[model samples]
Target: MPNPSTPEFAVVCRFQGLFPKDIGGYEKHRTRNGGDLGHVDPTRSHLNRPVIGKADWAARTIALIEDMKAENFADEIETLTRRRRKKQIKERMAEGPRDPWRATRHGPMREVILTANRDWFDALPTAAAREARAQAFEDAARDWLLENFGGDVVHARADLDEQAFHIHAVIVPKVQVELNGTKRWMLQPSKHELIKDYEAAQDSVGAHFAPLGLKRGERRAEAVRKARQAGEEPPAYRQHVRTADWRKAEDTRIVETRAELDRRTEAVTAEEVALEQKQEAVTGREKAIGAREDAAMAKEKEAGAVLAVGQGLAAGALDIEDRDGTPALIETPEAKSGLLSKLRARMARSSSGRARALHVFSKALARLREKARDEAKTAVARDTAEIQSADETIVEIASRLPYAERRSIGKIRVSLSARIMALTGRDTSRKTPAKGEDDESP
Candidate 1:
């Protein structure tokens, strides 16, 4: 039998700063019995204690969900949503009798999530080596946080030894004093939000440090000021100084190198802006030409259809006069009775020996009219199909273009139906198709 795969290791890190005022009463109402909230376990202890005593954990998790919804962090939500059932402790307390001290006991706190793939690191460095690496990463991470977020890092600890190598940190923001001398930590809106910003900043600064073999947070402020005076962007200034430090004998070379890089970056940014403006101009002109082509095509088809119908009507080939003074144009039950009248008029106008000729001719006229109507209907159908095919082509073309220039030409069904109706002899004052009607090309 194959050896079982190593069981996945799990680690958790949490921080507790303060408790709310009505926390004790809430715990009493929350627990099956009076006990420390953090010591309870349903699987073994079951003494009415919570696995995590910090009520702020439940509150902050809810706040994280709201923030995720605002920032549209959909990738992280699956992990967050699964933990909702574990968050029912707050709901259970809210059902209890009102307590005046609830707000005091349930204050805000910082929360962060960090994890590593333990399987990759299972080659196992010595304890001393692992600690050194962890400390180095932590120090690098902290320096990044201070520069961007302005906070004093308070604590860092691993969650689990066997499974995942992860750290949890608690940071107190720089204290700001009021005009009256009261002081408080500058509020961090969300722990997850802060952690993400820190991670992104580190990635940016760390990548810059790696190629030159320079450690992060090493460049002095004076070098940056001089480079800035020479018109370097902040990141480029630091890069130049770090590269010079690595070379150690090239002070003169560093100045010229930094100046050249800055010039190149400015040129690239200007080129990109110009290209975007030119693209926009080209798109605008193409759209104008397309709109004109569509209008002309529609107008041309309309003129052809009118010409076909007018020629047919002028020939009087389908027109019939009835003996009862009725025209064969009106379509109704009363008008259909005039069909017999139309037949009698034909016989009266026929030769005396050719009485049956009128009946034969009347039948032939009915057949001819039906044929003409069918042909007209088929012509409209063919045009409709062509129009629909054209619409699909337009959509396919627009999809490949950039978003700002991808103007909608409307749906093939609605627009094609309207255009086809206009080309044929039908009303098109509505947007939706008639019930049970297939949307074909014009």
Candidate 2:
């Protein structure tokens, strides 16, 4: 009873499930004239009466049930429904534990109980006055039940012999539900729950008697909601129970749960702090990387600006790769400074006589290609360091040549177009010197 609590004087309306088989015994208990009623005081047992029903509880219940069955044609529908369920159970057996109707049974009809605490009645001046006030409470509760549950409410009776005046009712709700496109009637108590959700059901009985100044008791739901919103550990729910042992056990459980909640909240706080610090560290690293990228781009811009100003890069493509030892058609669009500086140093190193001899060697390379044009490839192992050195010298001379001749000039020749073919040993890269542009004699 953590929710829908009734104050000591307020109305307490509650419903319980009553299965079809248990109806007979319950009807006997409600309609009994004077046999041993468990919680009833033997001296006041005669005080119980059918305050709201047309007859005794059992007789009224039987009449209403008959009327409902005849009006809704329940027998034929129940027969067909059973046959279909049986067929389905048989057909789905191959699916093992997945049969839909395997454990399915009928839900119980509704048995509602409404009452107030005995202290309110005791505080009254006279027994007659208590009876009148109890009558008022009973009338209001009966009216509320009839209004909500309609003709489905079978019987209502008053028990004055109990600790407090209370009303007992049985409502067998005949609900219309559609299954597989066909609509039919069934006794289902849960339909009332759909009509009024849990919280509203709890509020209804108390609100009906609000003019009497009686109030609903406190519950834990609202407090739990606020706690979650504030990011705090919620308080454990404490159920209202009568037995001392049950209440003590629930209290113990709540205490243990509160301790567990506090521990979990502290751990979550620590994790959030660690996560925040990690995110800050990652942000710092990203900023450092961005700064380095910005610096590299700025350096490239400064060097390219100087090259554009000093060299005639805007006028022609400057051959940058040939000035380095690597023979390539690549130009220095941004690194023209490196190419200009390196070429000046290397050309200054070559003597005048040496430059002339290197120029003659370049002419000799062209003649070699012409001579080997028709010669068949021979298996020759060569060590051509002098040829490679001569190739470098020719590149220095080509720096002074025009752009087309510069591209066509160097990567000077070896002896013949004999590719390196080592059949026994490990083979190296083919170093066959290519034919020059002027020696295309084929």
Best by lDDT: 2
RMSD of 1: 41.4
Give the whole-model CA lDDT for all candidates, comma-separated: 0.44, 0.59
Candidate 1 TM-score versus the reference: 0.21
Clash number by candidate, in order: 12, 0
Clashing pairs in 2: none
TM values, all candidates: 0.21, 0.43
Pick by TM-score: which candidate is best?
A: 2
Model 2, 217-288: lDDT tens digits are 454567788899999998887543322345467778999999899999989999988998998899999899
Model 1 misplacement above 4 A: 1-107, 113-115, 124-132, 145-151, 159-162, 174-442
Looking at model 2, residue 9 earns an lDDT score of: 58
What's model 2's lDDT at 202? 64
